[model samples]
Every structure is written in structure tokens, then in C-alpha cells.
Target: MDVRLLAASAAFALVSSITPGPNNLMLASSGLAFGFRRTLPLLLGVQAGFQCLLLAVAAGLGVVFQRHAEVQWALKLVGAAYLLYLAHGLWRSSSTGSAAMDRPIGFFKAAAFQVLNPKAWMMCLSAVGAYTLAGAAYWPSVWRLVALFFVLGLPSITLWAVFGSAFRAAFQNPETARRVGRALAVVTGASCLLVLL
Candidate 1:
């Protein structure tokens, strides 16, 4: 694998992991509700799930979607629907209560969501499409790319969770917390739309 391509993959992972998305929004909510320490499992689960997904994509399973138009559309449709669901949750959050929120999502659920998340899938697709070379060396390149992502990905995701933890301070007021939660949910939904469009 080329050094430049490796750098690009790292950069992409950093941006995708750190940016506002369903995962980060949930992390922020978890942080505000349960404290950063409690949310660690959730964060770790996300990283693990994404790494697995990347591995699958690298192994060519993700490429199968390219051959089947129906599968591609199904993924997009499901992804769009999930984002809308998240948006509704946000738009409906209460604005005037103590930062009362559900307990943080468990590791299993968070990991599973990664499989369904459009944003995650898109990131994997973009990485595979852009970085992996063609022809006889493709498999080797894919393996290197996956390894690189695992190395670069964990820290990048951790940073986003930390950012979410830091934002917990803004949730001191119940009403404020509720309002912020709703806004975050909306952003999550919007991100899904952005992927589709």
C-alpha cells in the first residue's frame, strides 16, 4: 500500500469518527445521562463494531453490494429510515427537565447498530472504493487498509466519545439537556439524509 493512501485513510477515519453523527449524538446523551466513565463500554463497542465492519468490507463482502442493485437500495432505504427515527427522538426531547435520559445503550446494541448505520456503511464504502487498488494486488491492499484503519480508528473514535463527554457539562439543566438532545437527534437524522443525497 502507498503511504499517501494510508494517510488518506487515516484522515478519513478521523473525520468520520470524530464528526457529528448518530454514534456521537448517542455518546453525548450517554455521557450526559450516565457520565463519561459509564459510557466507555458503549464507545468501545462502537469502535469494535466499526472495525469489524471495515474488516468485512476489506474482505470483499461489502463489495457484493455493488453487484446487486437491490441490496444497495435496501441498505440506503433502511439507513434513511433509521436516521428518521433518530431524528424524531431528538425533535421530541423535553427541553425543561433535569438531564433525565435512558441508561446508556448496551454494548451489543451499539455494535449491532453499526451494521445498520448508513453513515458507517458509507464510510466503509468510501474507504474501500478510494483506497484499495485494482488487479492482482487487490487482496493484499485490502488487508493493509483494514489494518491501517484498525490502528488509526480506535483513537479517532475515542476522541469523539471524549468530545461527547466534554459536552455533558452543557446538560446541567434538565430543560437545556432535553433541548440539546432533541437538536442532536435532528442532526443525526440530517446526516443520514446527507448520505442519501
Candidate 2:
């Protein structure tokens, strides 16, 4: 890949990772509930899952998605359901003030979550489609783009976790934390609509 193309891939990766999305929002929510140290697994798991998705797309799985409308519909339904469930969980956690919320989502669970995250799918597909140069030589370009994304996405995503932890101080009061949690719930739940869009 040309140096310019590599730079563009890095820029796109950072922007996509930094933008407010289900994963970043959830990371922030988890950090607020469990603290940054505790939410680390979710952060790492998301990166791991993302890399796998990127690899799959590079290997041409995205074309299968392009051909199968029903598959996309089914995935959208499942993803929407999962997002709604998480929203409800966050809502209940806020209302109940239970320690259960302190248990951050596990590594495997977070990794599994990437498949259901429509944004993740779109990112992987778009990266492969847009960043990789066409022709038989595209494999090298795919690897380069994936590598750049992995390198750039880490700090981009970490900022959300750090920001959430910073909110810990601002939300020192139980009531304030509760309010933040409820607000997060609304954002998280609303992400479900992205499936339709």
C-alpha cells in the first residue's frame, strides 16, 4: 500500500473508533459502573473481536453478506434484541443500585458482541472495500489496512474508557451516578434503531 493510503486507513480507523457508537458508549457505561480497571476486559475484547471481523472481511465474507438480504435481516433482529436487553439491564442497574452492575461484561461476551454490532460489521466491510486496492495484489493492501486499523483504534477506543472513568469524579453522588446510568441506558437503547436505518 502507498504511504498515503496507509495514512488514510489509520485516520479512518481512529475516527470510526472515537466516534460515539454502541461499543464506545458501552465502554463508557461499563467504566462508570465498574471503574476503568474492571472495564478493561470489555475494551480488549472489542479490539480482539474487531480484528477477527476485519480478517473475515479481508477473506471475503463481506461478499456473502452483500448477497444475502435475509441473513442481514436476521442479524439485525438479533442485534436489536441484544441492544435492548443491555439497555434494560443498565436501566435496572441504575434503579436498583445493585452490585450486579459492577460485574463488567465478560471477555467472551464482549467479543461475541461485535458480531451483533451493526456498526462493527459496517466498519469491517467498509474498510475492506474502501481501503484495499483491487486486483490480485489486494491481499497486501488488506493486511496493511487491518494492521493500521488495529494500531489506531486502540487509543481511540481507550479515550472513551478514560472519559467514563473521569466521570466517576463528577458523579460522586449515588443519585448523580444513577442519573448518568439512566442517560446511558437511553443512548444504548436508542442504538437499536440503527439496525433499521
Candidate 3:
């Protein structure tokens, strides 16, 4: 793959990966409660999941979904429902309890989340459309594209985890932590909804 093209793709991937969204919000929360070390699964999940989505999109699956209005609507509905479910989970947890916050979410669950995540879809669409070269050798281009996103994605997601871990110091009380978690959850879900709009 061309180095210039690779660099450009990586740059675009960084912009999307680092941006505020549901994934970032959840990462922040996880990092705060579980610390960067524990958030590794979540970070890996984000990269692996997006990598799959990018592959699918490059294979023209996104175009298929884009062509079908009903399919798109169904995806939105599912995404909304999932966000609400996440919101409820966040709300039910202790607002300030460090014990409750210590455990990060499991890997499989986080990986599955990418399927219904609107933000993930948006990122994939953007990457496939903007980064992947149209006329270049298909396999090389795809590999390079995937590499660009993966390279930027891991660090970007980790940063959110670190941000969350950093916030731990601010909430010494379980009650305060619970309240903040609930609030962050709400914002996270809301951010997902905005992608549908």
C-alpha cells in the first residue's frame, strides 16, 4: 500500500476513533471504575469489532443495508432499544460504590455491542468511503485500510479507558460514583440516539 494513502487513512481513523460518542463514554466509565488495565477487554473488543465491521463495509454490506430502508430502520430500532437497556443497567448500579465500579464489562458482551452500535456503523461507513482506495489492489488496500483503523483505534479507545481510570480519584464515595455512572450512562445512550437522527 502507498505510504501516503496509508498515512491519510490513519489520520482519518484517528479523528473518528478519538471523537466523543457512546463507545467513548462507556470506555470512560469503564476506565474510571476498572482502571486502564482492566479495560483491556473493552479496548480489544472495540478494535476487533470495528475491524470486522470495516471488512464487511468494504465488501459492500453497508451498501446493501443502505439500499434497504426497512433494514436501516430495523437497525435503528434495535440500536435504540439496546441503548435504553444499557442506560437501565447503568442506572441500577450503585452511583458511588467502588466495589460495583471495579469490574469492567466482559469481552464477549463488549464485542457483541459493536453489532448494534450506531457509532460503529458510522465509523465504518466513513472509513470505507473515505479511506479505502477505489482503484488500488483490492487485498492490499483492504489490509492497509484495516491496519490504519486498528492502529488508531486501539490507542484511541485506550485513551478513553485511561480517562475513566483518571476519574476514579474524583469520586471517593460510592454514592457519588453511582450518580455519576448513571448520568454518564444516560449521556452515552443519548449520544447513540443522536446518530440515528
Q: Estimate each model's TM-score.
A: 0.82, 0.93, 0.86
**Candidate models: Cα lDDT each:** 0.73, 0.84, 0.76
Order of all candidates by lDDT, from best down to worst?
2, 3, 1
lDDT of 1: 0.73
* Model 1 RMSD vs true structure: 2.6
lDDT of 2 by residue, 11-38 (tens): 8888888898888988898777778999
RMSD of each: 2.6, 1.5, 2.5
Which pairs clash in model 1? 90-182, 95-175, 96-175, 97-174, 97-175, 98-174
lDDT tens digits, residue span 52-102, model 3: 888988898999978888887777778878777666667666543534343
CA deviation > 4 Å runs, candidate 3:
1-7, 94-103
Worst 10 residues of 1 by lDDT: 93-102
Stretches off by above 4 angstroms in model 2 are 99-102
Where does candidate 1 stray beyond 4 Å?
Answer: 95-101, 134-140
Ranking by TM-score: 2, 3, 1
Error of 2 at 167 (Å): 1.5
